[model samples]
Target: MVRAAVVPAIGAPLEVTDIELPEPGPGQVRVRLAAAGVCHSDLSLSDGTMNVPLPAVLGHEGAGTVVAVGDGVAHVAPGDPVVLNWAPSCGSCHLCALGEVWLCVNALSGSGEVYARRADDGTDLYPGLNVAAFAEETVVPASCVLPMPAGIPLTDAAVLGCAVLTGYGAVHHSAKVRPGETMAVFGVGGVGLATLQSARIAGAERIIAVDVSPEKEELARRAGATDFLLASGTTPREIRGLTDKQGVDVAVECAGRAVSIRAAWDSTRRGGRTTVVGIGGKDQQVAFNGLELFHWGRTLSGCVFGNSNPSEDIPVLAEHVRSGRLDLDSLVTERITLEQIPEAFGNMIAGKGGRALVVF
Candidate 1:
């Protein structure tokens, strides 16, 4: 039996409970989690914004040590530190063949499998987002495990699975932000802050960070925002003013809200690009004028996991963390135990902190 924070149903608070862990089946491995980052996506899953089956273990951003492996799993061994890749690629998929492995056809189409069973009623529990790191132990596909280097702290590397990959990938791959380009990022959450730092790494000349809360200003600037503004109706105009009325070359919406998405679109200059990295609710919609799409010549794109190929990108990101190029420390604002997940969710809902890690 292993301890886990399980969401009994949509809109229900997570409960820390024990569950029976099945041994890793073929091509699977059991990970003893060292740390898990409480991401907004987990919140979406719990609140019904993103649909998944009920009574699931909710967490994806995690790092851990492999404790056991099943048949045909040779790439990793027990005692090895690894980061979970929630969207593991099936190399033979059409998307993978085209080098767009981020959209692996089987990425979300699970086999309706259950890796753990409830201790009380023997109810089968789904592993949310495939990795299920809200537990002390989780069984996942061996391919979903990326080996971590020794130097990087497992606690810090936990977020590389999601936030860093998504944010950095959005800037470098989705937007292809160029040197000296002006950039605007809406939201200063984990992914948004990572985007801001990535923009700085990409040599963006003027980086603007927008958020509703005034408390995030210091952290936003530390993450490389040249200017900060409150998210509001006139945010686009303010961003334009900062860029000398030219607007930003790249505008990223990380808030996953309709207004922020529109703000991202409105803040980009003619022929510039706007990338939506947030996973908004299914019912939410962002409106745009039909004529404006053609007249503005601006590109609007959506990024999934930052279009990252986990096997290839995770190591590079780990290197960045080691070399001080990526500031994971400042991004981690708080650390708590596994039992504190509910409080972590509260903080996330209130937008109270940067990244909060459930450290073992």
Candidate 2:
């Protein structure tokens, strides 16, 4: 029996339960998860904001060793250290064919459940995202697993699947930020910080970091933010001052709040791009004049999973971490077990940690 943390209901703490795990079906692989990062998306799932099915095991960012592979699978064998891709690129999908696998229209295996429930007498358990890493072992599609290079720590690699990849992809792929360009990022959370570092790597002349927390300012700076804004009174004016009163060339919104979205739109330069990376509500809507969108030639874009093509980007990100350029080590703030997922998630909701890893 494999112990798994289950969110039996909505708007509540996750209950850890020792449940049996079934073997992989055809085209699936069973993984012994080594570490899993607690992401904000999972918290959103619990509160019904992310549209995840209930009584689900919540975790997407994970690294593990393959224990078994089902029939017809030849890519990876047992004991391969692999990163679980929450968003797998399906080759047949239109987006995938266009090299935009992150936008793959099919979410069945890329974003939804892959395992079954035995306690309920063979009832299917909806797995959160493509990989539910909060358990000792998870069954996933072969496409969702990526073999990691030797010597990279699984614990650190766990976050690379989501936070690092998403952030890096957003800057590199979504906005195509260039060196010496001006970039401003709103929200200093994990993904936001990753975005900040990517901007630095892209050689942006000025990278501005904005957040409500004074504590995250230093971290953001270290991650390559040249200027920091704490969302004080007259924040727009403050940002305008930093950019010669012209606003930043690119604004990436990592905070899902309505106010943050508006700030991103307002802070972008006349012809700059505003990329929305954060996930928000279905009912939430932003107000913007249609005329300005056309007259200013300003573009408002939304990217999911950082517009990443998992097959190509995941390995590249791992190489960045290996070269010590990505800084995945310092990005990790806490490590706990599956039993502590509730507390770990709570801390994330409070915006108190960098990244939390659940080591199985």
Q: What is the per-residue lDDT of model 1 for residues 1-360, given as tens digits with 9 covering 90 to 100?
A: 989999999888788889999999999999999999999999999998988887899899999999999999998999999999898888898999999999998886542468789998899999898989999999998878988976888878898899999999999999999999999999898998899999999999999999988998999999999999998899999988988899999999997889899999999999999999988887668888889999999999999999998888877877887888898878888899878878888987777778889988
How would you encode candidate 2's per-residue C-alpha lDDT over 299-338 as one tens digit per residue? 8899898988777787787677778778986777788988
For residue 177, model 2's alpha carbon misses the true position, in angstroms, by 0.5
Candidate 2 residues lying further than 4 Å off, grouped into runs, are 109-114, 118-123
Model 1 is weakest, by summed lDDT over 10 consecutive residues, at 107-116
| C-alpha lDDT (0 to 100) for residue 251 of candidate 2 | 91
Clashes within 3 Å, all models in order: 0, 1
Per TM-score, the best of the predicted structures is 1
In model 1, the clashing pairs are none
Return the clash pairs for model 2, or none. Answer: 113-127
